[model samples]
Target chain A: MAAAARVFSEKGFGGASLEDVANEVGMLKGSLYNYIKSKEDLLFAVVRPDADELLMKARRLSGTDLPASEKLRQIARVHVEIIDRKLPYVSVYVQEIAGRGISQEWTDMDREYMSLIEKAFMEGVEAGIFADDLDVRVATRCFIGSLNWMTRWYEPGDPVRARAVADQLADVFLAGALARSRN
Target chain B: MAAAARVFSEKGFGGASLEDVANEVGMLKGSLYNYIKSKEDLLFAVVRPDADELLMKARRLSGTDLPASEKLRQIARVHVEIIDRKLPYVSVYVQEIAGRGISQEWTDMDREYMSLIEKAFMEGVEAGIFADDLDVRVATRCFIGSLNWMTRWYEPGDPVRARAVADQLADVFLAGALARSRN
Candidate 1:
């Protein structure tokens, strides 16, 4: 999967072939077909673990007894950590997920990920832990957007920046753009 | 340009050739080369206008005497309005900008757009208008990402929703996720 991810990231999904993944992994092209039927399958397999990891961790966090705010803070950190660690896989995932040949599971997993955050926002608002006027869907997206945007600028091997982003973004999301006290 | 943008957006910069753009704009493929040298040029031409519009508007806003926070409030609105209005061109820009054949100006304009926001964030902090401890780059990117992320889900012809996003996001950026009063 790591080999396939590097191939796809370097060549793009459309440009990559089964042979490239085979070359990357030192397998015969025919042998590659035994495990993956097509390049899209290879692409899917490469991207799925990262996506699944995010969803799985999000589910575990949601299942916790922690408050919505704390859940989101941890969610933000986990999200940054995974993306920081899996830049190549996540890059291909972000670029190719919108194309048609990708599985419906991609869309489902993405929606569920956002839905988890949306639920947290609703819970926060309901518990008077967040602003009552907050549009849960909008807030959820904006928060996710802030974290996911890191993919554009974040470099791998820079755990410190990623950690700062997680903590700072969590702070920004929690405290918002609003100043703590007016000067 | 509209025709070119539609062709590029539909067929993609790589998939679409000079002939497709020429046909969309009702020109001879040979003649089209007289006006536009390559498919990449056509893309740069189409995407450039929207990019220019955003930069132009941001430059205009920055010249105003408004406080940095107020300037950002308007910047948020303008960014949303432009993206909502020019979804197709913007979509193509976001998707294709990183590919090799695209122009350098694409990256430059994008950086300038963000630099404007970064400057505002810096001014806000330096002038005691924003939190002193704010990570300007992170905050600026987070704010811009919240706006840019709208591209993934924002459907065209939804002015009401666009306005709501602009206002809500601006508020969120300014007010932040912090509660005004903790329970």
Candidate 2:
């Protein structure tokens, strides 16, 4: 999967050949087919772990008894961590998801996880933990967009920068960037 | 350029053809060459306006006598408004900018505009108009990422929704989502 991700990242999903992936992993083309059905399948195989990890994190965080603010903070951190850990796969996922032949299962999983975040915003607003007038859907997307954008700039193995970005972004999402006194 | 942008948005950059763009604009493929050198040239033609507009806005706003907060607010609105106005071209720009054949001119322009935003953050901090501890580069990218993500969801011709998104996002960038009372 790692080799496939590297191949797809370098040559886009349409441009990458299954043989290139096989070469990267030291497998013969025929042997590769034994493990994956097609190039599309190989692409999905590479990205599924990212989707699974995200859904796993979302479910676990949302299932906890934390307040909405805390939940959002955790969500933000976990999201950054996932992207940091799976940079190659996530990059391919972001670039290719809108293309033809992506699985419905992937889209369904994405929707489910997004709903969990939206639910968090709704709960936050209802509990007076978030602004009452907040548009939960757009706000949820704003939060998601902020974190996902990290993929374009976040470097792998830079734990210091990673932690700083996660903490700072979480702070912004929960409390805005304005100093407390100014607010 | 408009016809090329629509074609590129519908078909990924690699998939789009000069013939397709020519057909959209009611011209012959051979005639398109009279104006564009290649498919890649056509892409740069379509996206150059967005880059030019961004740098133009950034330079103009950064030169203003407005406070950092006001400057940032206007920057946010203008940023979103441009994406709203040029959705198809901007969408192609986001997807293809990192690819192999993209023009250096585009990347240089993008970096310049981003640096302008980073400068805004730095000035804001120096003037005590923003939090003292802000990481100007990351914060600026976060701001850019938030606005750029609108290309994914901002529906064209829906002025009402566009205005709401712009205002809501600007508010978040300036003050964040936490209620002032909570702060």
- Of the candidates shown, which would achieve the greatest TM-score relative to the real structure? 2
Q: Can you tell me which runs of candidate 1 are displaced by over 4 Å?
A: A15-34, A98-102, B10-34, B98-103
- Please, what are the lDDT tens digits per residue for candidate 1 over residues B49-126? 778888999999888888888889888888888888898888777767732334566677777888999988888888
lDDT tens per residue, model 2, B1-183: 999889888777765778889899899889888987988777777888777887798799999988877777788777777777788888888877832334677667777878888888788888886778776776777778777767766777766677778778766766765666742
Model 1, residue B128: C-alpha shift (Å): 2.0
State the lDDT of candidate 1 residue by residue for A58-143, as single tens digits.
99998888998999989998999988899888878876773223467777888888889988888888888888887777788888
lDDT of 2 at B10: 78
Which residue pairs come into collision in candidate 2? A176-B176
Best by lDDT: 1
| Per-residue C-alpha lDDT of model 2 across residues A19-83, encoded as one tens digit per residue | 98989999999998788899878787788877788789889999998998888888887878878
The root-mean-square deviation over C-alpha atoms between each candidate and the true structure, in angstroms, is 3.0, 2.7
All candidates: TM-score: 0.89, 0.90
